[model samples]
Target: MLFFILTTIGKFLTKDEERDRELMARIKARDSSALSELYDNYNRLLFGLILSVLKKREEAEDILQEVFTKIWENAEKFDLEKGTVYTWIVTLARNKSIDRLRSKVYKEQKKQSTSLNDDDVFHPLYSNESDPLENTILSERAERVHKALNEISEKQRKVL
Candidate 1:
């Protein structure tokens, strides 16, 4: 009797294909409950994959949150026809981790200004100007990028 009951409970927990499908359907329909279920089911896996690539627990956790946020927002775009939900979540996690890695590297490099010369191309053409023409061009480019970036939704920009 004990064995039978235990086996029955185990099967109930793991063998419900309809339940999985239903949760996915709900997710596609923008159900918060479905997002909860997806997070409960896949967060660890995704986080583990991210930590593997990033080698930092806190960074991985942060990236995991961002990835799931995107997953929740973009659930409607998910297509089981293309691949399993596991694959999709893992891919999102991986991509976001790489993006974070690159961002961190960029920030570190930005903080360390090297090779500044009096005749640097970026030195301003005007005496009052802080930077040159090359610098002016780069600054303008940076400004345009900032403006373009401001046009994107905050949620979308978090990972970017």
Candidate 2:
């Protein structure tokens, strides 16, 4: 009974994957309706992911729109061998959200630095104060590097 249930679940998942592939093929052919259908299927989930990253409804909405726009423009680049359609779209949404977030942080930093006068430079070239955004970015980069290092052989990882 357990084997039967697992097999049935697998069949349903395969059908969903086939449907996603069909939609992607239509999108690659420049079928706007297919794009709309894809958006309808994924928008809520993607929007929730974007909003979680951005923590702002308006910015999340903007990023979600951009994610779809990218999907529309780059449909031909999709490769099932690399990953499933769901993974591709989710990655696009997450990346767009992160890009927007990084830009916002950079803009805020630029604005703050520009507002400082010559007298502000006298404090020190470096300070004990930490910028939370900078720390977050550095930590993320470090985590990614650590993951990548772990993926390689020990010799290669040690050399890097």
Candidate 3:
């Protein structure tokens, strides 16, 4: 009886497809319960991933909260056809942590009047003002990118 019950519970918890769909629908409907369920299920995983990237508990916690807010606001963007909920959540947490890390690095660089390593592209102390020549070059590159994507096969495009 115990083994049977445990197996049943495991199967229920493992139905990620149904769970994600239900949770996403509820979140879209502004259901706090579903949001709480999502947070409870993935909070520790996201926190750990963020901590590994940010290397600070406080920052990780803050970014974890931000990630949850983002997920709540953007729950409709979750598409099973594209990826799993875990992948979406993990990517969200990872990106937020990396953004935080970059912000911190930029600030430190600004205070010390130094570049972030050999790449000074992120130096907040400097400004890249709008230039018509630069804008025209970027527009041409973007058009080329769109043309290249359209020319590629589905499999090749997916790999890209």
Candidate with the greatest lDDT versus the true structure: 2
Model 2 regions lying over 4 Å from their true place: 1-15, 114-160
TM-score of candidate 3 on Cα atoms, chains taken together: 0.64
> Which residue pairs overlap in candidate 1's backbone?
122-132, 122-135, 123-131, 123-132, 124-131, 124-132
TM-scores vs. true structure, each candidate: 0.57, 0.63, 0.64
Q: How far does residue 16 in candidate 2 sit from its true spot (Å)?
A: 0.9
Those runs of model 1 whose alpha carbons end farther than 4 Å from true positions after fitting are 1-20, 114-160
Q: Across residues 39-137, which tens digit of lDDT does each residue of candidate 3 receive?
A: 888787677667866788999999999998998899888876554465567668767877887888878789999756735534432236653323433
Q: How many backbone clashes does candidate 1 have?
A: 6
Model 1 lDDT tens row, 37-124: 8788767666766786678999999999999889878887877555445545656876787677666655655677654443432122
Q: What are the candidates' C-alpha RMSDs?
A: 19.6, 11.4, 13.3
Task: Estimate, for each residue in 30-130, the C-alpha lDDT of model 2 and write its tens digit.
Answer: 99999998888878777876786688999999999999999999999998766567667876886787777766765765888765443343232224676
Per-model CA lDDT versus the true structure = 0.65, 0.73, 0.70
Which candidate should be chosen as best, given TM-score against the real structure?
Answer: 3
